[model samples]
Target: MEQLIKELESRARTLRYRIVKMIGPEEKGHLGGSCSIADVVTALYFHKMRHDPKQPKLRTRDRFLLSKGHAALVQYAALAECGYFPLSELDTLKELGSRLQGHPDMMKLPGVEANTGSLGQGLSIASGMAAALKLDGLDSKVYCVVGDGEMAEGQIWEAAMAASFYKLDNLVAILDRNGLQATGRIQERFNTNPVREKWESFGWHVLEIDGHDFAQIIEALDTADQVQGKPVMIIANTVKGKGIPFAEGVASFHNGTMTQEQFARACQLLEAEECEGR
Candidate 1:
């Protein structure tokens, strides 16, 4: 368990620097939100998920959908780290003719199960996967990470209800509650507080934790797996751009550009974190 935590931490640190290095001037990135969920992605890809890098389409493997597709950098970093593709290809993010698009594409990418963007849709797709797995009698699980801002969509709730109604315990939804949306805080734009009670009302098991805390995340995931006759939802309270000192906990940095000096600073912080883990 200690080794898993250390491995996840090292991956999270490396992911941060890769994100920064990948984001140059006018770099076309989603730094704030992506960085905020790096730990969660790291934990999932490296420690939690059961997958084969050589055979991404393995039927019994766990499933993950980046519902908040704007944070493609997070998924890209994880994919690279997990050997879905070469890490060097990340340098071409958002570049024309590059396989790495701004959003995930299942057909184009090996590990990506679905093409996700335009919030509130991933849950429904996940529900379908869960339902099919149940029918096929496959012991597989589906995990979807949605943004707090994306919770405002009515479709999300509908999917939530359907998952509960069908008793899709193998389906897990994680909400990255970093407080801000594209324009403002979720409270200001469309308050979705009391998120726990709301999911409970829909007959789903709900757990909330600090999104960046590895221990808490693992605990919640364990609890999520124990839930039966219902689906599970984890509301992970996170800071936008978590590890970067200059960018952490702010909405503006979510999609802003970083200067070369700033990138170097970010790299330093990430490198220090890796060295500490060592």
Candidate 2:
């Protein structure tokens, strides 16, 4: 277990570095949100999800959707690290003719399950996929990550109701409660506080944990498997711009740019983390 945690931690750092490298100084991408979900995405791809980079379309493989699609960089990093595609492809992110775009395009990318980034739509899409999988008698599970700010969408609640109504136990929704959204604190904007009670009231099984804690993440996912009658929701508490000293918890970094010096500093911090883990 200790070794597994170490491996996952190391993988998260690599993913973060790649994310920072992909969003160059000229174009500010979704840095804060992407960094916030790095640990969760790492855990899902490396430790939890049953997937194959070699056979992405293989039946019975687990599905992952980034509902808050602007955070596609993290998923792209994970996919590249997992061999879904060559790492060199990451260098052309958002470039014309590149599969790595600003948002995930299922048609263009091999590992991306849905075209996301508009926010509030991923849950509905995931619910439909979950229902379809169950209808076909497939045991595969569908996992969707939604941002706290995205929960303001009425469609999310509708999907939540539908999941519980159909008892889609194979559906697990992870809430990235990173507090701040693109503009500012979610509470100051579209507050979605008391998320736990809201989810419980929605008739779903809910678990809360430190998003960066590998052990807690692994345990919560395992427990979600044991839950039977309803879908599971893991409310992961995270920090925006995690792992970078200057960016951590700073809302401006949500889609902030990074100069060459800042990028170097980010790399240094991630490398330091890797060394400490070693």
Candidate 3:
């Protein structure tokens, strides 16, 4: 178990590094949100989820949807690492005609289950997929990653209510409560406070935890698996731009660019974290 945690931690750092590299210097990207959820995304693709890279559409395989699709960088990194496509393709992110776009495109990417990024719609899509899987008698699970700011969407609550009403236990929604969004702090923009109570009121099995801690993340996922009725929502408290020293909790980095020096320093920080784990 210790080894697995260490490996996952190391992999998370790698994913962060990939995000930094993908953005490079002076090229804007969704760095903050991507880094904030790196640990959870790492835990899913590398540890918790049952998926096959070689056969992305394999029946009975679990599905992952990045509803907060701006952070598609993290998912792209995971998919590339898992060999869904060439690692070199990451360089073409957001480029004209590139398969790796700013937001997820299920038709362009093999491992991506749905085209996301509009906010508040991912949970709805995931709920439908979960329902379909259940109807098919498949024990597959569907996981959706949503941003705290995105929770303001009315569709999210509707989907939440529907999931609970239908008892879609096969669906799990992980909330990246990083506290910051593109413009400013989520509280300053659209305060979605009392998240836990709200989710509970909507009839979800809620689990709150430190998003960066692999132990808590894994345990929450395991606990989520045992939830028999209603969907599970794991509210992961995280820091925007988590591993990068200068960017942490800075709202500008939500979709900001970096200087060459900043980029180098980000890589160094991520490398140092990976080495520390070793």
* Overall lDDT per candidate, in order of appearance: 0.88, 0.93, 0.95
**Candidate 3 lDDT score at position 95:** 90
Off by over 4 Å in 2: none
List clash counts for every candidate, in order: 0, 0, 0
The sequence of per-residue lDDT tens digits that candidate 1 reaches over residues 148-232 is 8888889999998899999999998999989998777778778988788899999989899999989999999888888899999
lDDT of 1 at 132: 98
Cα lDDT of model 2 by residue, 221-261, tens digit: 99999999899999999999888778889898999988788
lDDT of 2: 0.93
Q: Which stretches of candidate 1 lie over 4 Å from their true place?
A: none
lDDT of model number 1:
0.88
Per-residue lDDT of candidate 3, residues 102-198 (tens digit): 8999999999999898989999999999999999999999999999999889999999999999999999999999998789988888898889999
